[model samples]
Target: MGLEQIKNEFNAIAKTIYFDKAHFLREKASDEKAVRIFLEKVERLLQENDRKLEELYFVYGVFGNLYRVIGHPKKAIHYLQQALCLAERENDDSRKVVFLIRLGEALKYNEEHEKALKTFDKAMDLSDTLQVRKYNDFIFQHKGKCLLELGHLLEAEKCFLEALHIRKEKGDPELVASTELAIELVKKSK
Candidate 1:
């Protein structure tokens, strides 16, 4: 019943309600209204005393992804970079790899192909060092897309093939089909 307790309870409810709504809207084809609401709620949550660093990381990461989905690569890069920094600060290599892949994709979207390739390289190295095979396919797929945009057809095909192999092993038909499409695009480009 106290002021502090009431504030805490309100924050908890707001976090769940706002974030869930934002995510649902985002999933519905990256609605612009969703981005606006998400940004507003995230700003308010960030002003609260109870925000944790992990929560901050998640918020930044999701913000970056939403921006990317909405074709705002510059904004995506900014927030994804912040998320990557937080992951590094926490010494979380797994999260670092994830953010790197996302940041690399944003960079690629912004036509910074060389920088994107470097970012993907860093992600690949870190994922390999951590023995985290789960993200290798993603790393390869994104990197391949960057290379493709840069006109490195052969290298792009190689990366896509690697991704296809991994995705096939994972037995996800959708993933396999996606990589196959990439490979076909490479072939057509040649």
Candidate 2:
């Protein structure tokens, strides 16, 4: 099969793996294992043909996010950093934003609030320059997380409110409620 075909197959598998990990199943350890399996499969493909750095980064990103969700901050940050380098090399703003967000979350969980805020700032700038509205709510949410952690209660509250507004605009009551909960956290912290 050609490279495109391989990429298509990888995309399909990654989507399924991510979806299962996020929604279909609720076991973090199992989800991490499953994500690793997918990463190993992609690594083998990379071993056979190492030209597709972009594809490798994509898998690394998935691995990073899985580990992050599984409470493995160090491993998640490592893979996310790798993915961020590739994203920057490729000048792919979308991937840059995504990798930065994942890395920021991992850093925040690792108690590296300063570093996480810097990462989120870079992502926020890129998202603005790229005009990527899809990521705005999520960026705001994560930024709020960092702010909340750093004791910037007012800023955190604003971020959560902005995120909540976006969620409501999207007509996702569930997401709105979740964002509201974050707002509640900010209020409580204040």
Candidate 3:
């Protein structure tokens, strides 16, 4: 099969998996197990064909998210790092920022606060340089959490406010609530 065909098929399967992503994970007791099984099947197919670096990245992101939800922060970071490396080599700036944000989040949960802060900074820089506002809010949210942990309440509050602005602009009710919660936490802690 041609590379285009392979890419299309891979993307189709990926879209199907991601379509019911939250519902599937929330309903399954062993969500990670189900995700691993699906990934293994896809990986076996990829091994036979060997194509589409971008698809591989999407798969890695899926697994990283699953590992994160399953409480395996180390594995989550590992897969996210792999995705980030591929995204960088491919010059896929959008996915690169997303992976960086995910990696930073995993690192934060792993208690590597300093490294996570640096990672989040890189993501923020990319967002600023690329002018991509959609995922940029994530950098602010994560950075705010890290700063709050570090006792930089004012800085954290600023980050949360920026995130809140983005969420409001995007009309994302859930994120707006989250940003408000972060602001409240920062205020209450001080």
How much lDDT does candidate 3 score?
A: 0.75
lDDT of 3 by residue, 157-182 (tens): 99999999989999999789877877
What's the C-alpha lDDT at position 45 in model 3? 68
Q: Candidate 2, residues 1-190: lDDT per residue as tens digits?
A: 3457655755654454321222212114434465566556656766687556756776677667666656678988988898888888888888888888888888887779899888888888888889866778888888887787688989988888999988889998867876777776667667
TM-score of 2: 0.71
Pick out the ten consecutive residues of candidate 3 with the lowest summed lDDT. 19-28
Angstrom error of the Cα, residue 59, model 3: value is 1.6
Q: How does each model score on lDDT?
A: 0.76, 0.73, 0.75
Candidate 3's clash total is: 0
- In candidate 3, list every pair of residues with a backbone clash: none
Question: How many clashes in each candidate?
Answer: 0, 0, 0
Question: TM-score: which candidate is best?
Answer: 1
TM-score of 1: 0.77
Q: Residue 65 in candidate 3 has what lDDT?
A: 64
- Which has the better lDDT: candidate 2, or candidate 3? 3
Model 2 regions more than 4 Å off: 1-54
Stretches of candidate 3 exceeding 4 Å from the true structure: 1-51
